[model samples]
Target: MTFRLTFCSLIALAAASPALAEPVFNRIASFATLDNMAGDEDRTRATSAEIMTATPDGKRLIYSDSPLGAIGLIDIADPRAPKPLGNIAMDGEPTTTVVLGDTAFVGVNTSESYAKPSGVLRSVDLAGGQVVANCDLGGQPDSVALSPKGDMIAVAIENERDEEVNDGAIPQLPAGFVLRLPVKDGQVDCAGKQVIELTGLAGIAPDDPEPEYVDFNAQGDLVVTMQENNHIVVIGADGAVASHFSAGSVDLDGIDTDKDGKLDFTGSLKAVPREPDTVAWLDNDHFATANEGDWQGGSRGFTIWNRDGSVVHESGPAFEHALVRIGHYPEGRSGKKGAEPEAVKYAEFDGARLLFVGSERGSAIGVYDVADPSAPVLRQILPSGIGPEGLVAIPGRNLFASANETDLGEDGGARAHVMIYERAEGTPAYPTIASQDLLGWGALSGLTLDPADSSVLFAVSDSAYKNQPAIYRIQAGSPATITDKIVISKDGKPAETIDLEGIAADGKGGFWLASEGNPEKEIPHQILHVDGKGAVQQQVALPEDLTAGSTRFGLEGIAMAGDGMLWMAVQREWKDDPKGQTKLLSFDPATGEWSGVRYPLESGEGWVGLSELAIHDERLYLIERDNLIGPAAKLKQVTSVALQGLKPAPLGGALPLVEKRVERDLIPDLQQWNGYVQDKVEGMAIAPDGTVWTVTDNDGVDDASGETFLWSFTLGTQTAAK
Candidate 1:
């Protein structure tokens, strides 16, 4: 039930609260109802136009109503006293936002002009209380991201919908484009000193890069999440196609795994399959991805693979609930409720010891111990919120952070906040929701944990249209202490692009990132490699081709290989162009060299949803969201056909079907829950015991009784010729 409290009651509670009180109740009981500015009078009602972000110190919360054109800052430094800091008026509605130092980069646009877009990159100086730079963008900008040191800015530009509204459907809308500008001191060079255009990204829908999900690595590499082609575009500062990864364009609703009831998290109850946006790494050789299952009742999940382009495991709908729980019915006699199969949306390994799974609809985070890969066991569960988009593990303090994209309601009110959990340093690990920070602007989009220093973190939001997507450098104050934030933004500009989706720190003092450029023009996605000081060292552009234009599968997910090379995941394109095929590639950090291109999946390949990817011990794990109708939902494994091709089984030495059946009979019950039979699997992690831990998206199969589950598996005994 939704609860509302008065301002006086909140103050009284805070005054009487203890310094170290832990919030044990569900979210609804903890967070207060934000002041509604839409003037709708329904104060408790929430919408999707709000933005949220964590502080650079991982403390305090910031939020803004992009549609309402107002910013709300809350001093979450004290979880008990989450009071508002202040509010600021925006020029227009903010489509996306980014924060750096004391400045916030905001994208201003009008809601009425769906297509006749006009905006500029405005720099909001938090300390100065004025816009430092409001440079005209020529075209409407969608997403934005700052370099590690805040030297470069990227924005996604799109076509003017109203300008060419009658121009024969605007030629299916020109491809999305990205603009790269250099930021120095407190000034920005927006006069097109360095501009890169990406054309031919098919399947990208209108307002394609909606939830500004863009990122940049230490070396200034860029990765932009595009919903149109459902892929992440990767480009360098020099305007080159470093590589590409595909996330088959699809949504995460209407999928069924067990055919129970209550559409599994957006009708993911049915299973058929899917595609990409977010990405993470298991190790140097492996990375992870977050995909949209399918548009028409398909599976939604993640994927994993090796640096050499080999599929290791694919899992989806890991948990299937058959038991029913009774809920009070007003009239009594309404009969029973079926089981629901919840799907897993995001997954990642915490410093190689624990596996974390985020469920989009489940609104929770599932944890697994990967000490023994083949026997990963559920260790604990934590309640999260809408679009639990990003996860990061802080090593030194044994802390974990989950980025909540929306408020308690997915409807998108401006109540988004960042939640932090920490495990006791002593014995049997116990995790408590330690603290939370309110981001008054931009929804929490993505997060990246620092391998070298857990105290340092990077987080961003995912909306490019209504502005307010930003990145924050957080310094941990204490296990329960609020964080100190340093917003990352362009030179002195308040308005920029939309989202910052991907973020990776270069071990050698730098970072790599990708951002949604211009959505109006068919521009190539941008990637940059920057030094620790936040200086762009090199730049790359998405491959220019018909598929690149239509698919927008520019480089989406990215990771650093054990061999010191950068790996990228590309999405598939709908156009009949050779570049539309999804593949994995590698790039050199020092020489700006990109190579090792391998197409693991063919055009219109195996499944529809191939969202997230992870690589482990030379094995690639892909999250294949199978989208199908009726019951019987499943996930699939795309074992590297390249590896399968390596060992041809000596042509005539193939085992007979009868013999195969006999061998299968010798094995234990493979259909049992948690059983691994090479079905549809998405997220995976390698355990210390040389086994693999995996999770699946059930998509609420049996009567809305669907669930997310964890699984374990071992490598085959027979050593295949490698």
Candidate 2:
């Protein structure tokens, strides 16, 4: 089930990294959810890791996989390289899982209808991977928690309402409550079950107090989040309600409120309800909630609260702003809950008390040092796989784990994944290039090193921000930052029909941009010359002979050759070219003539094509990568075609094949990020001082973690300090 391919498992490195921060958590390994169902089953089906818990020694992990109707397990004996222990079949959908000693207690939902919901508590032996006991519950369960003493289990019996009926308005019958079961000798004592009533407490939907999530503190006190009702409740050890209150609202400012193709965070949401999704006991007297709103509102942040329902600290828009600064903001979800913080976990790491908040939509987790609960400090933000639904920390081993619940298997996209991270003395190994919103940006597609200053670079965003296509000026510093941005303009307005994928600097204080064409989308395959002021000076259309043979996978990168002629790299084979070959087009600015040569491409599993082109030392350096992601990504390299004897033939004539030499296998550099290999290695450049810089596009935060990795290598040249 764990296929280890030497070629794909190779880890490439760019620079030697010591600790960037004294105590930081860095990714160690990633396991795909489909690996658990790799036998005779249809592994292509959707799978998920909704909730998870690790063993006492951190040697194994048990998680709920609802889509597969099973409890999945992973052997973390070697934490850095986790191996799948396979999934144990469950009679019903497992909602949440909790580990106690040698057994895993799971809440299983067997509901056939909303009105008559039913569930069961199943205990599975971790050693034998078999269900040892099952206890029937009168209602459905959503979350499961274990007592601090490991003597009792708490289950949030959420008889949830159907979203399809009347927009999922609450008070729709069959109210829910909390179920506490005693544990005797590592086995759940079903005979000692207690159903604690939790209805007629919420002001909005008092008749249906649907308990969504439950977490227990050391004093046998439990905090429950009634998500739909926007309420919170605390239950004491005697199975009696202690105190309850509204989760409350927040007035958020400087937030994006629309999906209008912009990263503008100037809008505001006033009096928004903090519909809490996941709750964690910050301490015996305090707790935290991720405000993932339902129908009413979502504060787009997190909040810390006292047991008596007093707000201690409110994140408001600060967390989402951190995501925006890292280019992980979900612009498409602006109209909804930005980032949608859904999971919260509290633990002590080393000598620091920490809180981990997971963003379901942004695919990011914000780590906070909660030593001072009233004023928590944002320590780090870890990139998670799509839809991080669950988080578990293994402090004993200094390891952290995330259960990412998104499975795009039906679309042949990335399956659900579980990522592991270790606390160590080293840099984060991600975001070599990041921003503090010096200028809001995303989807960086092309890079152009400053012809004069080796430390200055310029990059461009693609059609993702079609309404305002802009080129960013980057300061190649330790954490290469975006210092400024220039919006490309047409007349007096932002260019409309543009998909700027490549950029090249002209000698006359201007730039030549190659916009990949999508004719059906009204965008033409053309090149534009822009003055230093960012105004369009001239536009050149492809010759009819070449235009007729082009596809949407048009010109990807452009560079200036030795003769002052502009050269562009076609991403893929066109209608006229043979298989596994694309064109290196040349356009003479002085003569207004066009010629082309064939660039041979190596065959791979997925389509392999050029993404970027840079002219360094008279050779055409190009970034070539496959369209696949993760382990399926077999090719991501920088290859150069010597220009010494290269000649371009006229359009419609037989083109010459240019031989290439592999300059760098970029997979190593990409692997240093420690997550999955990004599919786009789109931008590459060589500084005047010989530093090799490259960037991967974030796809404008669409179905992505929106992590744009920018790093430099001094492979063949001396590393220079900027």
Candidate 3:
């Protein structure tokens, strides 16, 4: 292990973790959008919640689910316990929606092809879940916005081009326009529509004029963003063009520019276009845009612009840096758009003006105090569901919600969800563990407490960082934090090809690590002994007989017991084992002999297997969980076997089965974090005072919220309640 200490990074880490105070926003509950897939809505199929608006009374929510081609509603009367009302099929792709009174104005795209585009604006009665009226928009519509008095409805009819056709170039369309329609009784009059021409108003692709998103100011004027054209335009309420300007570029510095399994915010980029999306009006003369670059531009941040085509405030790389500091950086998109800021929401809560910025890639919402629109102060960042593509702030209920769009259910992953947060007089509870804005760490698969100091803990990274696997030292405070890093090396290079999943303290001020094997990835199940300097002291490969019929699943956890004995928890039922049983293997350094006892597995939905094991209070504790998430998650708990009657027989010949009992049901504890249940609860460590600390791996921020939850609870022997 090599310590690459840098003074600048150390200072950055110390200054980034903010201690939240009054009016803190904490996530109270999360509801899976798939729950309301009723009637023809298949439960196992994909669903999403995007572009939503809440009722004036803040009691109802309406959102466009593009994948399901429907608009879904939610009842949040209790706010903390949200219930799905139902989903109304729109017969086409519902892109966006806005609610005025109990009526929702939705934009439905029914285009057969980009060259022959067509769409309609449908007004739906919320109470009856019925489409009341349809106005042919003459083109594909994107964002739907309403005026302050709800008398005028503005829609950006973007006859969007086909990306697959000649690399998604602009000027390939029947030009788009901003359509303004008079609203009467919450219904848009199709005959009384005026299309404001938006051509020749941009520096890039001015002929194409593809309107991406639209919003209306308090003065009843429309502000539209032409994302692919890299421009912005403001049109008066009378359908006259007020002003237009290029949504210019930015010079970004100190950013991680490569997907190299490292969070190095020290790179630079110049003249990067801020092709913004999801525009929101902050005031009569000011508005904000999420720079979710589409084709030619994406500045990787958010921007505030003045109505007169001048920049107000640019959040260069601050928001992205903050995400990196919190271990939420999307390493997969480091080269494309790091933490792509895609959506913005503005609200005034009790006189405190708030701006919510959603990073689609980072999967977190940044809450900024925008009282001074020029210099918005970031107060807190709340974790949301996987991809926060849409958001709404209900000031009436002191609540904020996000519509996460990505669903990975087919792979047994987290489904799309609408998460809720409330501003209360308490601390933020989601990030049980935190890191300084400079420490790039996640996929925490292994943990071990320091023998001398429990507050000082060590953790290991899995293959998420396939290019740079290393170890981290953590300070387990009120909100546990990572303090130091040590890269395990061999031959003076990063030992990153192996997936390190289990760790144990060696009596000689070092550690013993278990590297899980994946034959597909050409990794072997091996054990290693490293000294305090991170140098490999000894290495042992699995015996040929035991490795003969091995599958991908391998050793998941390791623990040091008595004398020179080291125990390991195999992840699943490997070859030669019974259908529902896995082995707890033990190895002696003096004898180099391997013995094991069969651990009977409990049947559950999905595959039941072990994630972690720890020796505490004369008992061997195990984290047994099913490979399922969200509402499908059925098993995630801690069970233990007594050390009093433990005896390991020879591995090959009918090993004795060990008796196990439930010690803790971690489902409630995981739910206490107020998010969807993550599938990988892969690490556990015990302090000398009987405090058990556990963590879940975040898959290296890939297809995840990039949150590594680290929390502890006291464990007392308790029988299974069921």
Candidate 4:
């Protein structure tokens, strides 16, 4: 199998091969951590679902909630719809959890400060939600695992260093170690504890070993990853170190190594350390690590290693590059840790041995068929919530779950969530659109259909890539493929400071783009005309009278009307307009004259505004949405204004208001994917055959899940309700 296959090629392979047409994972439900809070509790407080584990029957999932200092439970009796079972408060911050029979062993941190670290292992009864036992661990705990035969439990005591002190350098004293205890008849024997010292094992931090994650293979051998030390240690069932080796390093090529507000994959990294985070076994002989770098290094991918620490295979930049093709690359984190592979899990289902690699920054999971551990094949990339920290697979029930630990609800963003996916007989439903030929793309703000071919479309990036504004030519299909990219240039260089939000194709091999401006930033609100080669030919700024009333929420969409006029949609109301009405401005190139009319907006909890515009079949279509995400999202829909009787008034005067009829409520369409409802429905275009295409803005994967959805639908000719 080829290693450099793009995401589209993988999908095509799965579709073409009968043997490969097996059950694929598709997200079926998402449970928000906020739902576990009591009705009287402050829902505004932060919460998280980090490390997770499932019951033997796979009917329940338990995850550690560090912020809430509790363990959250979810009942998955019906895999399609997960229900929150509330949370059980712990003595301190919960770090990890593992289920053995009806008991859950959780590691909790109760440290007062970095100098005085303390932790405990608590055993809870799953049915009654009560702590049954507690064992003092003498240090901060990070990861916990159960033995294969359920006869032993292991915990990684990571008395981690304080980054603020001496820049988080190691040898901070009170060296870390691993704890092993026996399990008797579904109960923890706290008194039968054994300590395995890890000092003098790593070259980087020999004394202060910070063990990040721990796992057990089928033979009860434990694998521990000391991330900051860049070392891996394996212990036998008798609690003796069997093998220890440095996680080593790799030289990365064809990667984006800077956070300069653009996606440039021409850079390279030399001798980057593979500071492994989560370690999981593929069998007794081989294991894998998510090389999530710490303070010094992170190789931006995963590594397959033998028990003796020899490299079986190194992903290098392939995993991160694969994410780049799917628009999940975290450009904002490029300078620090690109895509940050932080979690790994190995599971077998129906004779297929698979490995799941989770990207902490990119918020995606790369699935691979690792039947031949020496050469793993890239299978699919699954989208998760922001900051996927934990993954659990229950082969018994053919279900998998990811614990996303980032919660921005207090700031009106998506809350932490546990997304559940079920393996069934169908194709993967994610990655509705992807780029080919390694073309990195995201933040799709506007789209335009080609006049010559309805199956071809064009899209533009917003200010997310202000330094490298580009136009992407797309092949509009079931899973849209970006075939080409043209950088918008001025004076033989990439344009700068342009916040392109809308695009319209010119009949004569050119495009009309609407740039949404920020007055405070001095990015002018203007319309630009670019030729087929993406060279700026002309720029038209708003009139002084109109600019006087403008704010940052300026022009969002532009469309060429049938009457040879360019119509642009202003996102929100300006100072000169009445509340709940935004402008629909028209420009006649023949006369260079500007006119305008107001479009009424729907009443909603958050501010509603226009994001895109398209003119088709004598009707002007617009995407109207509120600035809310997840379950709070409402009013994401396509609305239309009939152009037959529409009239415009002159600028700096009383503008006529046009009535809008709702064409399609897009909230249902977004919900069909079974993920959180995205806030930015920023791009839409209509094919000549009346098909309506839409795309979402991922905000350049900054404080976002970076999941782009490109879907299409057709509407009937009947009149819609206003």
Candidate 5:
């Protein structure tokens, strides 16, 4: 550990005893090089999700591809030398992954058609140093959990089919079911396995639509979470419904499970299904979920529950009248209006429920009380300066993690870090100041706490800006510190940090990161790997297809799916040409290769800009920055796609689909009164229970919008427009 001891600390420690090992937060190299501008194809843009991860043995590093497809990979055997291996294709846009031995299960989805294999659940093989196989699934698989033996993979699947219209409008179906795929030997063939229908179990009408998330209990029983119904359905191995519990049911103060003299369940767990989100398993009988209501509701942060269907802890406030009372009214004498409350999700830490919750408007984390499963309560808040978009946590060490972006003066900036909390009682819940800042030390665009040890932290910075961002490490110790940054340079001079945004740890010895440069500048985009000592070991430039463009091909969000492969999401470059949609790409960590296929969103699909990118279990969770719409940000999940085999249909379409009403009413208000438009959504993280924890970059609300507010989205709930 390279220690950057504070001048005073160095003297005291040295004078008293041998100086403790400290990690120095030094600069390495910057990424620069414009690509595809000189009439050359292969240009790329930037997104906020550029993070990396290492293999279990620390021999290779994996990174995501924010290109047309949703995945990418890298090899990092040498600290100062990184290389790109190969890439692959997926059914839907790829998000996150979970690695076992040689297999990686990826989450994907398509619009309104998740019942079939629209959600591509790919099983990648990394044993041969290359991706050998990829598979697709019927439902939009959100998260993945492998049984102890790595067989019978439980994937939370959701089919967002359209609900029926009263007149001759487009038809929509209720939410679909979650599937448990059995990975036998080295292959994944869903047709040969048993598929359980979850619609009926959750009381979901065949026409009321909702998404499904699944996780295994301590005994390996499947716990399926439905955002619409606000319930968890336990599926036994026999494929029969074991039990069903309400996410909205809370153990009231009058009814105590422990027979204590206090209120048992304060606020119930409500279903705030906004978009593709997450849920987490707290323990064998306990679980935590994000309570951001559906398109018609509002919630902030997560809630804990016990197996007997009781709320143990409650954070934030409860939803009344099926809606989170967003007090937007102003007092008669005051000039300011009320601010909106937020929600939480994407939690981790087994012993303690450490969740990363952010507000749709405010850039902060809502630290809720989860000590009890029947009565969780909101306790403190961690304001991450700008938007707290993503979250990661490591238990047994009191370490909480998050990622966000801020302005470095005129130089727009981003940061990712691991904050060590003082778990002692009365410790002032959320520290006004961060335990340690990984700013210049590293990029806070993406970060992850080492599952192996919370003391070890990894972070990645987006280099798409002029300063080529890099990766850095931080170790927990007295006067806890950061290490020197590590990034590869071209032609001896470090490139301007384009956007080294995403990061992840392999839980072994090494770390990985992804970088995206300005395509208009014609610079090459690639993924890099680094050793614990902050050395650039390997690097891989993106593929031609991913970079072929003179427009800005923004490659950002990234993560490691299972199988040592990498997944990425990129914003389509907008230039002189007409507006079109972007795509998700994949890469191979073993050979620094690229997959030719890309998963394109629906035509006319538009995003204000993509920010925080995350993956958990087997699903992908990405945050679309404030898109001039209702609420301040947009959270989306890419679950299923229409893929026939290795081939797909044509590409080249309009921006992401935008409803006419959304454009006029929902989108514009995000900028309310803050002279400048709000770029609300920024960072994002996934909890073990499948909840999506995201932060906002409200840049301060406009006068018309009243006070500034942080926001969080529960999967099925609808939120108020900014």
Candidate 6:
């Protein structure tokens, strides 16, 4: 079962597959880490799934939950519907786990402080959830790997340094090393322990070698990454250092280098250190490193190297740029590690050698074809849960899983999740919308169909990019493509102090935009008209009486009604409105008059509000959702109000209430990708063919998974407005 690739054979395979359909991976299910908690435990408590391994039968998944001080188990009998198997308390922080037969070997760090590092290698029986054996390792462990023969285990003792001590500079006491143990009869042989010193191997800190990740090849050779030291070491099967070398550096160009809330990929860096994090063997002779720089450098990509430490190929910034095209670039991390490729795994499925690279910050996984290691081709980018930290492939079942370590449940955000994917003969289901070119775009808050073209639509961003407000033109198709960008400009410069939340085509090569405003910030709630060239033509502020009762949640969506009146959906109730009711304000540009009607909202567990508005066939459609994500999400739906009998009341008075009808429940639509339900259903548009399209904002990749979903469907028997 050994997989090997040569330069000539890889090139031949690349040119061999045009007639047959290639297998693609699509997410099938997601298991939240909190689900393993008992009924008596607080559900809001944070939990995580950091590193994971599957049983030899591939029927269950075991992951390290450091926050919970346990290893959680999952029953994957039905890979598409994973079930929780509860958690096994390890009495200490479990760092990594590897399974052989029905036993899981986990590295548990019991270190009280960085100065005194201590850990134990615990072997737990998966069937009974009991610790069967334990062996003292005499150091804090980070990574645990089982040999391909299942007879030996290797652990990386990462006696990590405290960042508060001298700003985390290395050369701290208690240098780390590698430990190897033999396994006999499905149990660790405690008496057969070997320690291999890794000190004096890295240029950055020769005395303190913090081993981050370890992996064993088929020949029982182990490859270890010293992340903080920016070095790599290979240990032979005989428990000795075979070879070691510096992980080296890379020069990056055309990258976003600032943390200024805008995505501008025009910066460059010289001689950036490729402080590799995770290394996985592509074959017996080649390996890949995830260059997630922890100290002085992070090249923001992955690299392939020969077993002798020579560079086989360098991805440079191509991997990060690929994420930019799909709207997953984390602008907030531009000044640090862009996407932060932190996890790498290599596997052969049905003769196709594949490499999986996980981005911790961007929350996505890049799938590469490594049949040709020197020129690996990116197959697809799969959306993982926030902060994917571990990846494991089960080629026996055509499945793969990622353990996301970030848990923000205490802050009312998404919890850590273990996402499962299956390989089959089908096209990729992600990246439903992407830029036609390498365009950095996100935070799509509003959408409007073009007046003259059914296949063309427009979208606008909110305050995510404060200084670079933009409108994007999209060509509607199976996977929608962003074709062009129009930066909203005023006085020959990009407009500032504007939070564009909605857009509507103005019929005459122009558009009207709804700008949500915060009074505290002095950004007025107003509407602006922009020409085809995106130059501001006019601005209209809300009446004084309306502004007097305005809150921060104002003017979310805008639409042009059939009667030549502009309609807007106020996100939440204002000071003068009744509870559970928001305003559907209207403006008559012909007479410069303002009026409004109230829109009823559904009561839910969290605050509910309107996010988008659209008009079709004399009906005003609205996107209504609650401010909850993951399993707590509810009330994401599309509702419509008939405008035929609608009447508006004068401002600063009792507004008329409009009756609404539920058209669709978007929760199921959001669940089609099998990830968590996104919170913001911010954009919607109706095409001439009666198709309804919607998009979810990614919050500009700020503390979010950075996944923007654009999908479309049609209401049965509905005709386009004539």
Model 1 residue 535 CA deviation in Å: 70
State each model's CA lDDT, in order.
0.41, 0.85, 0.85, 0.90, 0.43, 0.90
How many clashes in each structure?
260, 4, 3, 1, 230, 0
What are the per-residue Cα lDDT tens digits for candidate 6 across 261-363?
6778889999999999999998788999999998889999999999999999999988888788778898889899999999999999999999999999889
For model 6, what is the alpha-carbon lDDT of residue 593?
Answer: 94
- Per residue, candidate 5 scores C-alpha lDDT tens digits across 292-358 of 4443333443556665656566543332110111111111111110112222343444444544455
Q: Candidate 6: where are CA atoms >4 Å away? A: 1-20, 716-722
**What is the per-residue lDDT of model 3 for residues 1-722, given as tens digits with 9 covering 90 to 100?**
00122222323333444554457788888889888877675798989988888888998878889989999999999988889898999999999988888888899999999899999999898888899899999999998888989899899999999999998887887999989999886677889998899988887777899999999888898899999988999988778999999899999987888988765677999999999988999999999999989997789889988999899899888788777656788888889888999999999999998999999999998888888989887777788888898899998889999999998888778989999999876666756566644667788998898988888889888888877677788888655777777777777777755789999988679999998987777788888888776777788887777876678889999998856688899999988999999989888978899988999998998899999988887788899999888767889989999887788997668899999999888877778767888889999998778899899998877798787788888888333331
The best candidate by TM-score is 4
* Model 3 superposed RMSD (Cα): 3.5
> By summed lDDT, which 10 consecutive residues of candidate 4 come out lowest?
713-722
Residue range 358-446, candidate 1, lDDT tens digits? 55444455554444433444444454433454454444434455544454323222244444555532211111111122222112223
Prediction 3 global C-alpha lDDT: 0.85
TM-score-based ranking: 4, 6, 3, 2, 1, 5
Q: TM-score of each candidate?
A: 0.43, 0.94, 0.95, 0.98, 0.43, 0.96
> Which portions of model 4 show Cα errors greater than 4 Å?
1-4, 13-20, 717-722
lDDT of the structure predicted as candidate 5: 0.43
Better of 2 and 6 by TM-score: 6
Off by over 4 Å in 1: 1-30, 33-51, 138-140, 158-171, 201-212, 248-273, 279-287, 293-298, 305-313, 319-358, 366-380, 386-722
Model 2 Cα lDDT, one tens digit per residue, 1-722 = 01111111111111235633457777888888888876898876888987988998899988899988998999999987789889998899999988887888889999999988999998888889899989998889999999989999999999999888888887878999999999888888888989888888999999898899999999999999998889999999888899999998999888889888867788988899999999999889999999999878889989999999999999888888777766788888999898899999999987889999999988888888898899887767788888899999999899999999987767546678898989887656654666635256889999997787778888989988888788888888656767677899989888778899999888677899999997567678989999887789899998888988778999899999767989999999998999999999999988999998999998998799999998988889999888888778889988998888788999988999999988788887777766777889899878766678899998887677677889888646432211
What ranking of all candidate models by lDDT puts the best one first? 4, 6, 2, 3, 5, 1
